[model samples]
Target: MTDSFQKRLNFDGNIDEVIERAANNYSLGNLKHSELMTVGLQDYNLHIITNQGEYVIKVFSKLRNVENIRRYVEIIKAALNAGVHHPSMLKDMKGEFIHTDEPSGLSMIVLEYIRGKTFYDMDRAPNSKELKLIAAETVKINKIKFKPSYLFDSWAVPNIHWMYKQVNKFLDDEGKNLAKTALSWYEALPIKLLPTCFVQGDIIKTNVVLGENSQIYIIDFAVSNIYPRVQELAVMSSNLMDNKKAPLLRRVERVKQAYLAAGGELTEVELKSLYNYAVCAVAMEFMGSYHERYVIGETADEISYWMQLGRQGLKEGLGEK
Candidate 1:
């Protein structure tokens, strides 16, 4: 493993300086430094504490191009205004997403930090009844009446094919083979079998926070886009599979039933393709692991566990019978 990675926190200053910049952007007073907690990626993550309160500063790696940051902020804003629960809020100091005159040559976005433990821990799964509630809330979010921003008409655009290219380009021979296998599996599946909608894209335990007042908040819309509901479901199911006691397949079925009960529309083809989507999703994680984890190094997340869960979902999603 590369001992030293081009990680975050190249600020070249102490938290006090960061607070100065933040205060200027948010138009706040001098912020005292609080203990910064590291989560998600490798660096650029700090939980600053001032006399006022706590806020999260997530410095984006160059991987997050200008367009990507802009689209994410805009989408999250839309989701919030549309009555969808999400992290605190974010605003771009500059006009939309533009090239920051930074040496890194990447655009940076600032969001109000929302604090909470990641929901991905194995113990985070709700009881049987609570799962139903989670499903209902998810359906309600999907039903939120709203329109997508014109800036990104094609949210899921760089399609799976493009994703494959990304995987192949970075991975070694073994990784490339994994990517190819994943590609063929997804290609073999009929798109018509999967229901379509705006998937949470990168739904994982950490992304969903169980907030105070018994509220559930889903944050991080960077990977979000309009895609097959099954695709999203598969990915979510795989996420839930971290618990060995609670098999991911069972959770998926329960979530599906709950989603349907909560007004999630599903067709025969869509329902059937759910399994395929799950399996293919696992392959995707495996193939993309290089770029996401190894190549990106510490900056990337650990999505390796989801690979097996996704494969398991393939069979379970196909049909329990």
Candidate 2:
């Protein structure tokens, strides 16, 4: 996707056409499997059936630099090798994730087929026993080197602040001020946030899958960022906001318990920081929802309602003075 335009991805205009080009690239005839397309908040995801299997073809018009995607894939591969329950790398095949310039000079990446439904599609949280396994797998990734400074140019602080300004500004002056305030809060945090551990940043159920073998697999690392352990929890909290089926507060406690049980560390100060970080992260998410609900067009609500919980947590945990 050349990205001469804005947030939209597929350069060819229609997703079907985009998939067609991908199908042609793979020399696939009209695939026996039905075309699968799942649209993320900001990108268009296409799944094309191939002789080998289903392959994910993702497009992003705005970011001409596909290096972010590359780094994430590498990180996932590293995490997988380091024991994160992630998709196995497709060796020697250009199918894991292929970045290419379209005829229009747009950019895209095709990922290997990961066959499984998202955890969100599951009827319930995988049995309590499964939860322990998931926590172990997720934290294993968090324990590794997730320094996103390597992706600063490709995607990092830029995406965060940009959305805060451009997207969140739509809400209100308070929302605008909240965005600015959150950034400063992170900058002036009491504890020194670690940068060594690799973090997925996106921990929503939808991004995770429980494979047929009862194993867990996390895919879609587009939002993956390198940050500290507590910061990782902040991102995870925001992800839970998008989950309306279950009460988020309960899920957080469970996930936190599971994470700690898996040997992840959490100091008292870190817990307090997590409150502020979660609030900041919540405000940031509302800003994103502002864009999704108003600017680009979407029906889901992810802002103020979710923010209210975060704000309350901040007030209670930080002690309103």
> What lDDT, from 0 to 1, does candidate 2 have?
0.57
By TM-score, the best candidate is 1
Candidate 1 per-residue lDDT, tens place, 27-68, comes to 444676644444354335556666666666555654555556
Cα lDDT, model 2, residue 227: 60
Clashing pairs in 1: 32-50, 34-49, 120-205, 193-269, 193-270, 275-317
Q: Cα miss at 244, model 1 (Å)? A: 1.7
RMSD each, Å: 5.0, 5.2
Q: Model 2: which ten-residue window has the lowest total lDDT?
A: 312-321
TM-score of 1: 0.74
